[model samples]
Every structure is written in structure tokens, then in C-alpha cells.
Target: MPQAKDHVYLDHNAGAPLRPGARERMVEVLSDVGNASSVHADGRRARARIEAAREQVAGLCKARTRAVTFVSGGTEANMTALTPNWQDQGAPYYLDRLLRGATEHPSVAAGGRFPASMQEVIPVDANGLIRLDILKDMLAGGGPALVSVMAANNETGVISPLAEIGAMVAEAGGFFHVDAVQAAGRMEIDMDAWQADAISLSAHKFGGPQGAGSLVVRSTARVPAPLMLGGGQENWRRAGTENVAAISGIGVAAEAAEKEAQDWARLAALRDRLEAGVREICPAVTIFGEEAPRLANTSCFAAPGISAETALIAFDLERLSLSSGSACSSGKVSVSHVLTAMGAEEATARCALRVSLGWNSTDADIDRFLEVWPQVVDRLNPEARNRAA
Candidate 1:
């Protein structure tokens, strides 16, 4: 776990601090004892709470209330969306195979429950945007397919051309699923406008409890089959009893996150300032996706001559929290698959560092970064950095 104190935290892409509204509601629901399936009044209250959360999460995607299905987290939501037709034998579903973005989260890129052969990648450009021409050529001859593209990337914060992608998928008669976990609170996403068939969201990414998430389908009639069969919950779209407190937290957090999205301009300005400061410290620093559309609160740059591992250790010693691309696997920094998809050279990709801001970030945090970051960069020698390069 990332230890946070008086230290500055620039890893909101990993997790945001829990919102007070969510915390309060979670505590209240914690003592309201009953399974959502029972006939008693307590059960009725629990069910109502869960349904209310469904509506709130749906609002974040501008989706129908009936189409939302609660899940464990973003991973389960992505996994569930990919395998909806897994058990429907002898019935022709709308989609026949999965085509995901090369830069998708590992959960979507590598976590599909379908057979490996059924899944393939859609490449991206150097700016981290999906290559539409290549995608069109791939889609033209395939059987009705399922396309998985993220609204915003977790690593470079690159925003995809969703409306255009949706149009292409529609023309090809395929279903479009968006892994929207990173964009939930930072940007507005309307299912109708984006033409997404299914969307996944995580609570912790938007100031809610970490254990809850949602999959909001564009149409209730097209809900995916439950991944497991434990009990009659979520109208059979998902099984197992709901987590009452966590669901309540998601409800309040969603409502709060909607408000948070309104302040993105300010966050984006702050991010730009941070990037400018980084450039002054090291003129050769490269900011990924700098010329493309991206989330307002994210800045990913590689200091010209420093390895990310050395920079991370130096930053930690200075009490500043940052990450090299997305959260590393098992606390070990590995080369980013996202940068790789954008065709980055091995050394450049390995040295990339991501600094993500959030709702609580302020001028002080930026100042701290500007103050200590130069020192961290100045301490590294190019000759010593070459070994890791």
C-alpha cells in the first residue's frame, strides 16, 4: 500500500482518497443488517439502497437506470462484459469475437475470459490514439465483433476518439464496450453520444469505496449473463448478495463525483503547470500524449537521462509519491504495455513517470513537486543512468 501522510500524493489514477459523503453513508448502512434478498423490512431497505446506487452510477454514464449491474470492481466488470454470451448455447448473439485496444488496461487487454484465439488487438499511434484506419480494415471482414476501447487511458491519460470509434463499430454491426474506470470522475461520458453498448466503472477511481463497481449497459434487454450463479440478485444479471455499505458508498460517491467533473479545467491547468516545471528542470524531458486529447489531471513525462526506478526511489526519499506509468505489478516497476503500444523505444518507455492530480490537489502539491523534483533530477548522472537505460 502507498503510505500517505504530510507527503504529497500524485497517483490519483491508482486511487483517490475516499469522499466524506461516501464515508458517512457507508457507516450508516454498515449497521442496517439484512441480505437484500429477504422479505423483511431490513431486506427491503437494503434492496432500495442498492437500486439507488445503480441509478447514481448510471448517471455518470448517462445510461438507463435499469441497465446498470453492480459488480465487485472494474476487473470483474470488464471480465463480465467480455464473456456475456459464454453460456448461451445454440443461440446467435450479436457479437462473435473480441477486439480490444492495444493500450487497454491489462484487465481488458489480457483478462478476457474468452478463448485466446477469439481475442485480438487494435493498434495505436505514437500519440497513444487508436489507429482508426487499421481498425476499420480489421473490422470490415470480421464476423459481428465486440470492440473494447477505454474512454481515457490510465497511463498516458490519452482520451480516445470515442464518438468516431463508436460510429465505425456501428457501421460494422458490432457491440462497443468502454473500459471507463479512469474517466469516470474526470470527464463526462454519455452512452448515447459515445455509442457504447456496455461501460465499466470503479468506485475508488472517483472517491467511492474500493470494493464496488458497476457495468451500465446501453439497453436493459441486452444485459450480459451473470458470470456466476450464487443467488437471485441484481435481477439475475449478477448473483450473490450485495454489499450494503459499499453500495451505499458508491451512491453518495457517484453523486459527488458528478460535481467533481465540473472542476476539470482547473485540474488540467495545474497539470500543465507541473509539466512546464518538469521541462525547465530537464529541457529534454518528453511528455507523452502532449499533443493529443487527454484527461485534465494526468501528466506522464520521461526525464531525459534518468531511469524511472531511480527517480521513483529518489522521489520517495523526498516524501513525494509518484508512479512510473500505471501502478507497477507487485510493487515492481515493469515496462509499460501502454507505451509499448504507442511504439515507444524500450529505454524511453522504461523511464516514463506518471504524475496524476485529483480533487484534493492544490497549488501546494504542485509547489512541492516543483521544489523537490529538480533536486531529484539533478542528482542523477547520465553515465550512471545508462546502465538501467
Candidate 2:
């Protein structure tokens, strides 16, 4: 599908534009023939492609090559990490409790394969920052727990204090898992530095194809049990034939994202400028997680009296692509769970919008938004428009 010349895409958080290298790599793999599980040369080649992708993904997190297990996407990676069936001396070991931050992506927030009765949700501060004190208290009362926290939030771009969380979990003798899907390509991740027992990643979040991701455990010797039982795929950690084409794209994309992180400062300036422009136009516009650490390319903000659904429709009509603060469900912009957890008023939460920039983003995209947004606010809040005028 050809894109309209005037159209602009700013919702990189939802899914980034596919990288050229990744696209080419995926197409190349699509032309190849063989199942990775077969013993023939064709199969051996396919297996090689899969292994290379695993190493590429592991390199992104500075994880051991043996620790990476390919999965379908972030959801599966998270599910595999959350399952309480890690092998300990050939016996099944289960986490006595499961805890997750309130602002985590739905995959982690849903408790993955863990039972709902065994799970507890941790609260976050009004700024959408995790409440460390609360987390510590929650851990104190629990047995060996599996604490899952996303390295960065998808909606607000708020970064968690991973090193601190990891330390606390380690001291409590619990395993710490990081859903680094949003953080993977945007920043450097060291499993040991964050003390993460396992980290989940998705290719589509970082300019790769969707449908391929990985769960990088800290050690191969103590990996989680497979969620599905069948073939010896993914070292018996996951059952299913590998999505070879998508995996190849993921490998190429990860390599590119790692290199692109070096030039993230360029996007930082663009993002800052975008946020500044919006605030200047509407003084009441409040940028979420502004006081907390955030991704360089992400800006989530809202103005009073202007719901995101209204603005999203206007922007879409204007050929400007942006996302609501929360996930868009069934073509509708629902109130942001992230904002609600931050103690934002219901109306304000409904008004929030997220604009995430990336490698393909340009000043023109921001310019278009700045131009169209005022018209939206004017229509939604005529009283505020009068005050601004």
C-alpha cells in the first residue's frame, strides 16, 4: 500500500515503520525453503537463520546466547517468563507469588500464564512511577515471588527504576523479569545491570516485523518450563515451528536498532521540541511522566476539556497519525489505564494522547501536529480557545 504524500505517522510506540534492512532480510528468508527442524541442508540453513537471529536478539540485551528463546511476540515472551515452572534440579519450581507494576502493558498486567489468585498488583505514584516503598512492603509479606515490571511504559513513556527494583527482588530471593519491549531498541539493556532474571522483547516495537520475539533468561541452566509441550523447538522451551522470515527480520532490525540508539540524541531534540510546541499552544496541556525519566522519542500529553478521541479523529482526518494515551480498542479510544493509575481525573485520562517519534519521524510531522492540534482544541473547548486567543 502506498502512503499518502501528506500523511504523517507518529505512533511509533504502537509499531514502528519497518526498517529497510529488516524488510530485505525478511524477503530473502521468505524465498528460502525448509523447516528448521529438518536434518536436510535446506533445514540446516533455516536453522542457521534462526540461531543467528537469537544471537542478534541476545546481543541487544547483553544476554548469553544460550539464554534466548524465540517466541511469537511480546505477549508470549511475557507469558513464558511469568509461568512459575522453572526447572530446579529436574523438579518443577513454582513462584509462591506474582507481583507487577500497575502501569505495565496488558501482557504483563494480565499475569501471563500465572494464576490470578497467586498474583497481586503493585501500585504506582501519581506521576505513573512505581511505588518502591509499596513494592517492598508487598514483597515482605510474600514468599519467593516473581516480580514482573516493564522497563518503560508504552503509554506514558515513563521509565521504571529497574536497577532498584531488581536489587529489592534479589534481596527478597525473588526473580525479577523485565518486559523491555518498549525499551529494547531505544536504550541499552544489560540483564546483569538490571538484575533481570528474564527480559521480554518484541521485534515490531523496534522496526522489525511482528509475530517474532524472544525471552532472554539470565541463565540457560535455570530456564522456565515450556508453556506448550511438543517438539524440541527453542531448546524445548517453546513448541512450534519458527517463523523464519519474521525471525530473520527481527535479527536485522535488532542490529539496526542497537546502532540507531547511538544517534537517539537527534530524536531527543525533536521530541522535546514537539512537546514544547504543544505546551506553548495550550498552557493547560500536561505532559505525563515529564518529571520522570522517559524514552527520548516519546511524548504523552493532554489538555483539559479535550478528549483524545475527539482529537484523534480530527488528526486522522488531517492525515496526521497519532495514538491515544492508552491502547486503541476496536477503533475506539478508551480511557487511559496508565493515567488512571497515576491518579489523573477520569476526564483528563480520557483526553490524553501519545505521540511517539522514531527514525522515520521528521520535523514536518511535528509541524503538522502543531498546526492541526489547535483547531481540534478550539472545536472541543471553545472557552479555552477564547482564553488562548
Candidate 3:
């Protein structure tokens, strides 16, 4: 068992370590007692904090503060975005259809379960990029449609061309929804610039408190009927008392991340070093999405004959915490849907490991990982060592 002292987390993609600032903010908010919707002074203070968070989240996405709607997390954000508003008198007929990338996170994928005939999957290329031509074709043939494409792949970190896709969707008079949960804070995200009707973001992905996320909808965009209705919270789009503390933490974290955007460049350098070390130590290893632009702090790699589960366990034994893919899944060992969509062989997909970094990462952290990685790989696949010998 790895002790806390030995563990070097490389699973920021799963969730970054909550920053001290975010924690302090949470503590500060928790000490207060007020319902944001109430009319009292304390309530007004709470509402102010919530509004500040809305602005911060909106700024992160280059959206208007009024366009931001808080949700429980990425899953809720996705579900809310995908849900249709039958109540809208002018709702498009295509609103009945939900088209998404086949490699989308389970939340988006599961949203398709509403009815198979009403759902369509846009295929991806060998590099895990959505097949834009197919998307254009589908849009041209569409009904009222909701197209959900993740801005960046959670497993492979391959960025989707949202600007292009959003334009295509708009040309076809369809709603464009982007799952920016993984893309937020890692890269520039401009909801208006991308022309995205809606985008989802999770605070935990960028050093904020977990259980807090937001959906950004264009001011011109029509609201879907509420996914949950009661108490008329979130402008009646979502209902429930606000999570004031978590939202406050998200605001602090977003402000910190915005102020330190250059940190991503630094983390990219460390990521490159880690990747270079892995390639040097294991020449046969294949890095996924190497041909395309990716998140600065993510590197997904695969080595023949060594399953991700094995490598993960070996690394864990060495006190290096990493992920096989999205932490939303149960087991660390599974064939990566992203890899499969990208045309990776089952063996290669199963062998892939995702090493992600974040705000807490340092040069020494990367060095420590490089130091242990070779031994972990060797221990998991002694045959590779024997072959080299």
C-alpha cells in the first residue's frame, strides 16, 4: 500500500487537488448561513457571492455572467444541456434529436438512451477527432437537433474542432452543445467565439472544489424546459437551494486559474519532459493523440503486452498515482472508448495509461514520476526487460 507521503498524483484529469485558496473560500462560505434566494441581508450577501461565482465562471468561458447556470457537476451540466424544451412554442423539430460524438463521456452517451431512433452518433477519425464531414452531412439531413461534442477528449486529450463544428451546426439551424469539462482551464475557451449554444464545465477539473460545475448558454439561446422543476432556482432551469460554499470555491479557483494562465505553459513543459522520458525509456511505447493538439498537461501512452491495469498497479506500488482513463468508470482496466474510436487495436487500447498534471504539479513531481515509471513498467512486463537483455 502506498502511503500519502509516497503518493505522487498524476490524475489531475480525474480531479485536481483542491487549491488552498479554494479551500479557504469554501471554509469562509461555510461559516456563513444564508439562502441566496432569501430577501434578508445575509441572503443578499449569499446571493452576491453566487453572482460573483457566476461572473468568474462566465469569464473563464468568455461568456456573459447572466448566461452561466450552476449545476451539481459535469454530469448534471451535460444532462441539463441535452434535455429538450418541448414547452418552447418555437422549438425546432430537430430538438427531438440528440446527435453526439461516439466517444463522448458516459453522461452524453447515456443521454442517448432516451430513444435509439432519436439518437445519432457522429463517428470519429483515427486521431479521435469527430468526422466533421459526416457531421455536416448529418446536420444537412437533420430534424431539430442537439449536437454534443466534447471540446477535449477525457481519455486521449484530443481537442475537437468546436469552432468548425459549431458553425456547421448553426448552418443547419441546430443547437450546438460542447462538453468543455475537460477543456476548461487547460486551454482558451470562448463560448461566443466558438458560437456554442451551450457548454459544460466542472470546477474540480481546474483545482476547484468538486460537486460544482456550470453550464454556459448563449444569451440568445432558448432555455430548454427545466430538467428539474421546483423552487424556481437557477432562473427556473434547475431547482434546489444553491450550493453556496462550493460555488464560492469555484469562483476563487477560477479567478486563480485565470490569473495564472501561463502556468499551463509551465505544466506543458513538464508534460513534455515526462513524455520524452517515457519515450526514451520505452522506445516501443505509442503516445495517443500525438498527431493533434492536446491539453497541455495530459499524456496518454501505451506499451505493448502491458495492460493499463498492470502498469497502474505497478505505479501505485511505487507511489505514483495515475489513471488508466476517465475516473468515472469503476475499474482502471478497460478498453478506452476514445482509443477504439480512434481505431486503436483492442490490445493497444487496453494497454493505454493516462498521466495528467495540474496546478499542484512541480518539476520534482515530474522527475519523481520519471524516476519510478521505468521500474514500474519493467516490473509489470519482465519479458520486455528479458528481450532487451
Candidate 4:
């Protein structure tokens, strides 16, 4: 195994390295002791910190400060938002159905509180983009539905047309919930522009602590019912003792991400270079969602006769961190649902690999990956190697 300094991390979609400011803020909060719910001075101080963080996190999505609710992570935020029952300004706003994108994260795919019978799947085209015409038809038939689609797919990095989808939902008198965990720091988030009812974000996806995330809504008047019930924390939406350190870390990360968002365009050049190098090595390599808009830092591709499990292990031994797809599956190398939804054959989906870069990624890192690619290809594909000879 290579030394830590030599290792190249290309899995930012899994979780970015914690930013220095986020780490510092976490340490600062951990050094103190205070309960945000307590009435004492210490408690008040803690409360102030949490509130400040709330504002910072909200700013990341261009949302109202009061509309933010701190949740455990992305999964919790999705579960909370995908509910059939919601309130519109203190009145019951019931959703008769849950219509979600076929390529949504597993959290949203599970349909949350909406029973299987009440849920429907919206299809995607071969480009991994939602079939909006089908979505229009689905909306026409359903009673005020809750439309759930991710802002950016984790596996393929494909970005959805959020503004268009949100407009359709609004016109149909439905609620639009965007799982924006992957899009948070990579794209501009304007709730007003998208007319999104709410969007979920995970701090870890953008360089904060893993446990902290937020569900930012366009309006507190329209919000999901509490998934966690007990105390009155989070304005009765989510009830638990505040994780001050993690939340503080999230604030620092959110602020940094918003300011640094413009710099991400540089990663697209790096990603293009990486993909071009792969294609040069294996002329027939498949790049998923290549025709669609994708996250600047991500590239998902597959080479013939190369299995993800083998490549991942080989890459790890070479001190190159890569992934087959989403890291949520406990490291299993399985066919990507995102690819499958886009009509990829099982063999191609099984061989898929994802390389994502972030703030610290450098040209040297991409160079290293290209240098290692040919060896992996030669070892895995004897036919290609013989042809090369």
C-alpha cells in the first residue's frame, strides 16, 4: 500500500475531506458544553451558535433562515420530506400520491411514508434524464402529488432540470422536493428560481462533518410533518438535542462552499482530461451520462471486460481511491440503478466506475490515474492487450 501522502482520493461524491475551517469549528464547539434547549446563559450561547449555523446553511440554498431544519443527514432529510402528509400554513396539505424519479437515491426510492400503493415511478430516457413528457402525464392524473427527484444523481452525476420540473409541479398544484445532496456545493441553488418546495443537503458531501445536514424549504408555511416527534427542537419539525459541533462544522463548510462554488468549474476540465485519457487507453470505453449535464467533479465510466470489484481492489493497492457508484451500499460492487434506469445492459453497469474530484484535487492526481489506467486495462482485457500488441 502506498503511504498516506501518496494516496490520491477521487471519491468526493462519497464524502469530501473535511475542510480546515469546518474542523476548527467542530473542535471549538466540542471544547464547550451547553444544551441549546436549556434556559441558562451557556444554553443561550449554544442556541446562538446553532441559530447562526441555521442561517449559514440556509444561505447555501438561498432559502429563508427560519425555513431550515437540521437533520441527522441526507437520508433523514429525504425521509422527512417524502411524506404524504404536510401542512400549508397551519392547514392540512394532503398529498394523494408520491411520484419520484426512477433514478432517485434509495432513500427517496423507498417512498418514505408514502406506502408502495400510493407511490409511482417516473421514467428516464437513455441519457439518464427524466422524461418530462411522462412526468406531465403523471401529474395530470394524480391528486396533488409530491414529486421527488434528485438535483444531481450520485452514481452518474447527471443533473436534473430542477427549474422545469419544479414549474410543472407548481402548475399541477403539487409539491416539489429536490434531494440536492450531490448538487449543494457544485451548483447554484436558488429555491425561488426552481420554485422548489424544499431541498435536502448533506454536509459531508461538500466537506462538513458526516452527521449534519439540513432540509431547506422555500417557506415555513409549507413543510413536511415531523418524522421525529418528542421535544420542540427545530420548531417541532425535528426533535433531538442539537449536535452543536457537527452543526457548527456544517455552517463553516456551507459558507466556504458558497464562496468557492465558482472555483468548481476548474474540475470540469480535470474530469474531461481523465475521461479523455480513459478513452485513449480503451477506445470503446463507455462514459455514462456523457451527453447530459453532470457535476463538474464526477465521471462515471466503464471499460470492456473490466469488473468494478477487481478494478477497485487494484486501484486501492495502488493508493488510488475510486468507487463503482454510490458509497451508501456498504462497499458492494453491484449494477448501478442509475445506469440501469438509463437502459444500460447489466454487463456494462456491473463494470462501471466513478471518479469524483473536489477542492484539493490537482492535475497530478488526474495524471496518476491516467498512468495507472493502461495497466488495469491490460491486466483485465487480454483481447485488448493482444490487439495492442
Candidate 5:
């Protein structure tokens, strides 16, 4: 096992290491003295910086500059997008309904629960892709509704067919919202091509600062009632003072990510190498979403009879950090919702580990993980290893 000083991060899906330029941008913003909303000269300079950042973020998603509304994080973006928009105040039925994929992140799940009676779950296939047939059926039977589907899953990295889903939602006259936090920097997202009404993204997912995110809403899309009410900011869509430093950092990160699309190919190759090595050394290991297209940097797999908790600890000991599931639910040691949605048994679900790469990943990182993984698994589940051997 490598020493602590040599620890390698393989949990980029949780959050990537901050880019070199992102920190510098944040520091520069912090050193400035001005409110983004102020009309004064200094304030105007800050506002210009904020607008520049907004353009960079919007460019990454291929969205209009006006479409991006900065928020605290992915959770806030999702909540803002999912909140019901009551068009007819006089109608007997107060319009409140949320449609979400079963494999969504906890934030989406929690937001779906906000309107308790209105929450509907969309099922997923064995590859963790949402069932289009099920979605179509729901849309067909729906009243006023909002459908929340992720562009790419965090745990398994399965990319959803958003363009088709968006068309279906548009046909049904229901709002379509996409959680594109994981897909923002990793995959190509063209809002116009997808025809999505709204999409959510987080800067930290793309090597930007934490606490900075955005909700991109099409011009024709109906804006939901604000969840928070206070000082007018975010064009009165979101309240409270903006985090200028974080926003600036996010913009820098977005610009860098957009300019570095070729990095995905390298990360994909490294991910494939890691999966191949795991399968070769540990024959019982099963790679999740192998039959489907996935994010270039992610590889989620399972080793039977070895719990994800044990594997995570073993990996940590070897100076290789990965995840059992979403970083938000790390300490819970629960079965993955993505795996369960994929039809994995509870035992199999509990044994899953997600290893994700990023811009900083190298062939040596993959080799280091390959060298340590088998020993870690053996140490964690000796009886199972012996049986397999």
C-alpha cells in the first residue's frame, strides 16, 4: 500500500480538485471591494466580472447568457427548477406535482418530496437509464407537472437520453427539467438540441469552487415561485447577496473545462484501464453500466461478498480514495439507489464502488489502483477471495 503522502484521489465524481486558475480568480475577486449589485464604479467592475463568469458558465452548457441564474449549489438549482408554477390561480386544483427518476441524487429526491402527494417516480433499466416508456406513460396521464431527470447519474455515470425525453415532455405540455451537474464538464450539452426547458449545474463538479451553481431556464420556460424570499438578487428569481468570489471562480473553471474537451478522451482511457485491470485481477468483479454509454471519467463496479464500506476503507488505506455512492451519503453505508434501480440485489448493491477520474488523472494512477485493489479486496474478504482463487 502506498503511504499517506502518496494518496491518489479517484473520487472526482464526488468533486474534482480545484483547477489552478479557479483559485487565482477567487482570490482576485476576494481582494476586490465592491458589491455586484451596486451602481458605483467599483460595484460596476464587480458586476462586469460576475457577468463575464455568467457568460463562461452559459457557454459551457451552450445556453443563453440570460438563461443562467447563479445559486448556492446543485441542490438549490434543483429545488428552484422543480418548484411548481401555478399558472391558473382560480383553478380548483392547485398545480403541484414532481416527476423524478428513481436513480436521482438525494437532493432531487428530497426536492420531489417537497410536495408530498405529488411526487412520482420514474423507473430505470438495468443500465440505470430512465425508462422512456414509463416516462411517456406518465406524461400521457399527467395533469400540470414537472419532470426532473438527470443528464448523467452520479454513481454509475449513465447518461440519459435527454433530447428524446425533452421532446416527450414538450409534446405533453409539461415542464422538463434536467439535473446536468455531473454532465456539465464531462459531456456535451446543447440546450437547444436537447430542447430542455430548464437544467441545473454545479461549478465544483467541473473543477470550480464549491457553493457556486446555476439554473438555466429557457426564455419560454415558466419560472417557478421562489423558495427563498429576501433582498432582490438573481434578477429577483433568487434572493440574498451573490457569492461573487465563488461565482468568478466557477466562471474560470467553466472556461477551462470548455477549452479542454480532449481531456475526456484521456480520462476515458484511464477509466477503461482501471476497469480492465480490476476484471483481470478480480474475476468476480462486475463493472456496472458496461452495456451502456457512460461518462468518460467514471467506472462503477461491484465485488461480490465485499461491502463497499470495506472496499472504501481498504482503498483509503492504500492511498487511493473512491466512493461507495454519492459523497453526500458517504457515511451511511447504504445500498446504492442506482444499483437497486439497475435491478441489482441488495447484496450486490452494497458491494458497489465508484472510481472516477479527472483532468489530473494519469496512467500511473490507474496502475497504482490496479496494484493495490486485489490486495485490498483480499484483506477485506479473505474467505471470498480464497473461494474464488
Candidate 6:
């Protein structure tokens, strides 16, 4: 679907616009026919494409090409990683429990394959940072645990201290898995530096087409147990026919996103300007995780007395596309769990809105949104409007 001429998109964290290179690659693959599992000449070509994509994804994470296991998307990648059964050079390496950040995505909050009794939550500070002292105490009481945390938060754009968290997990002799879905193309990913056992990524979160992703393990020898178990696909790691077209798109997008990271500072400046504009209009606006290091392209804030649900409708009518929080909530606006975990009150949490930028986001887009801001406030918040007048 073509976007309206006047519409502006600012919801990169929900899913980035597909890169042109990725779109072209996907189109090329869609016209071809071959199952990657087959050994015929046609299949060999498809297999080569998949392998090449794996290498590109590995390069994004600074991991060995052999460590990348193609999956459906971020959710599947996380589910495949957060399991009790893992192997060290093909031997049974079991984890006794699961520990995840309280502000994690809903997929991580579900505890994946672990039972409720075996799962624990590590609290975050008021600024949405994980409490290191509390995490240290929790680790001391647990057996070989699997600690799952996102490299960057989807709602607040807060960057976690992955290296520190990884060191703590290593000291506890536990496994570490990072959901780098939001951080994949936006930030540098060094699996070794973070000492992460595995990191999950979704192609769509970057600039690829949806439906393709990967779980990149630090070592193929020490990987999670096979989540899918029917065929000898993905080196027996995951089963099912590969989405060759989507995988091709992922490779192209990965290559492009790597190049695009250099221009991220420009996006950061735009985000800063966007936030400043919001604060200027609504001086009482609260920016979540404002003091923490955040993704350069994200600005999540809530103005007091302006209901997010009401503002969203106004924004939509104004042809401004953004989100109140995570787009995963099936088209409904509700209180942000991320804000709540950071000790925000229910009223303030409900007002939270996330404005994330992307590779193609421009100053014009930010200006257009800022231009529409006061009108939205005036319509939904009459008291604030009167005070401003």
C-alpha cells in the first residue's frame, strides 16, 4: 500500500520501512523456485542464497557464520533460545531456572518454554535500568540459570548494560541470551564483548521483510536445543522449508543497515529536536528513561493530562503514524508495562507514547509532527490548552 502524500511515519521500533535493496532482493527470489533442502541444481542455488544471508546476519552480530540459525522472527528466535535444554559440544547442558528483566518484551515475559515456578524477574530501577545489586543477589541464590534481557527496550529505547550483565551471568556460571531485535541494525553487536551465549534478531525490526530472522549463537558447540525437530534443515537446528525470499531480503537489509549506522547521529539530532519540541509545547511532559543511554532514533514521552488513546486518534487523523507504545498489543492502546516497571503511576503510564525514527526519517518528518503537536494538545487537553493561551 502506498503511503499518503502527507503522512509521516515515526514508528521504526514497531518495524522499519523495508530497505529498497531488501525489497529488490526479495522480489528477485520470489520469482525463482526451489526448496533449500533439496540437492538439485535449483535447490543448490536457493541454498547458496540462504547461506550467504547467514553470513551477512553473522557479520551484523560479529559472530561466526556457522553460529547463525535461521528462524521465523524475533519471537521464534527468543522462544528457541529460552529453553532448558541446551548442549555443549552435543552433550546435555541443562539450565535450572530462568531469569528475565521485568521490563522485557511480552514474549520474554511469557517465560518462553520454562514453567512459571522456574521463572524469576529481575527488577529495573526508576530509570528503566536493571538493578545490578538485586541481580547479584538473585544470581547468588540460583543454580545455572538462563538470563534473558533485551539489548535495547522497544518502548523506552533504553540501552541495557549488556557487558555488565553478561559478566555477572558468567560469574554465576549461567547462560546469557540477548534479544537484540531492536538493537540489531541500530547499534554495534559484539557477542564476545557482551559474553552472550546467544542473541535473537528479527529482520523486520531492521529493514528487511517480515517473517525471517535468526538466532546467532556465540559457539555452535554451545547452543540451545533444537526448537524444531522434524527435518535435517538448518543443520538440524530448525526444521521447515526456508522462506528463501524473506531470507534474501534479510541479507540485503543487513548489509544496508550496517552501512546506515554511520548516519545514525543525524537521527539522534532529529530525536533530540523532536523531544525538545514536545517539551516546549507541554512543559510537563515526562520523557521515559530520559537520563539513560537510549537509541539515537527514539523519543518516548508523555505529556501530563493528555491521554495517549485520545492523542493517538488525533495523530492518526492528522496522518501522523507513530505508536502509544508497543505495536504488539493487537491494535489497542493501554498502559505501558515498561513504564509501570520503572515505577510510573497508572495515569502517567497510560499517557506514554513512543516516537522512534529510522534510516529514512528526515527533519521534515519531525517538523511535521511537531507542527501538529499543539493542535492535538489543544483538542484533547483543554485545561493545558487554556493555560498555554
Best candidate per TM-score, number?
Answer: 6
Task: Write the candidate numbers in order of decreasing TM-score.
Answer: 6, 4, 2, 1, 3, 5
lDDT of 1 at 110: 75
Q: After best superposition, candidate 2 residue 210: deviation in angstroms?
A: 1.3
Error of 2 at 85 (Å): 1.7
Give me the overall lDDT of model 4: 0.90
* Per-residue lDDT of model 4, residues 159-191, tens digit only: 999999999999999999999999978888889
lDDT by residue (55-135, candidate 2, tens digit) is 898888899888888888999999888987787556777788899989889888889888899999999997788899999
Model 3: per-residue Cα lDDT over 94-182, one tens digit each? 37688899899999998732466788899998888899999888887857788899999988888898889988888888888899998
Instruction: Quote model 6's TM-score.
Output: 0.98
Residues 244-357, candidate 5, lDDT per residue (tens digit)? 999999999998887665457778888888887877766777788888889999999887788888788888877788898544443667877778878998888888899988
Model 2: ten consecutive residues of lowest lDDT? 380-389
List residue ranges in candidate 2 displaced over 4 A: 89-91, 386-389
Candidate 1 displacement at residue 349 in angstroms? 1.1
Q: Judging by lDDT, tell me the better candidate of 3 and 6.
A: 6
Q: Which ten residues in a row have the lowest lDDT in candidate 6?
A: 380-389
| Inter-residue clash pairs, candidate 2 | none
lDDT (CA) per prediction: 0.85, 0.87, 0.83, 0.90, 0.82, 0.90
Tens-digit per-residue lDDT, 1-389, candidate 6:
98988899999999899999899898999988889988998899999999999999888889999999989999999999999999988899999999999999988999989999999999999989999999999999968999999999999999999999999999999999999999977888999999999999999989998888999999999999988988888988998898999998999898877777656688889999998888888777889999999989888898878888888889999999899964455788877788989999998888888998987888999999989998998888856643441
lDDT of 1 by residue, 120-189 (tens): 7999999999999999988996787889999999999999999999999999988888999999889998
List pairs with backbone clashes in candidate 5: none
How far residue 312's Cα lies from its native spot in candidate 3, in Å, is: 0.9
Count of backbone collisions in candidate 6: 0
Using lDDT as the yardstick, the better of models 3 and 5 is: 3
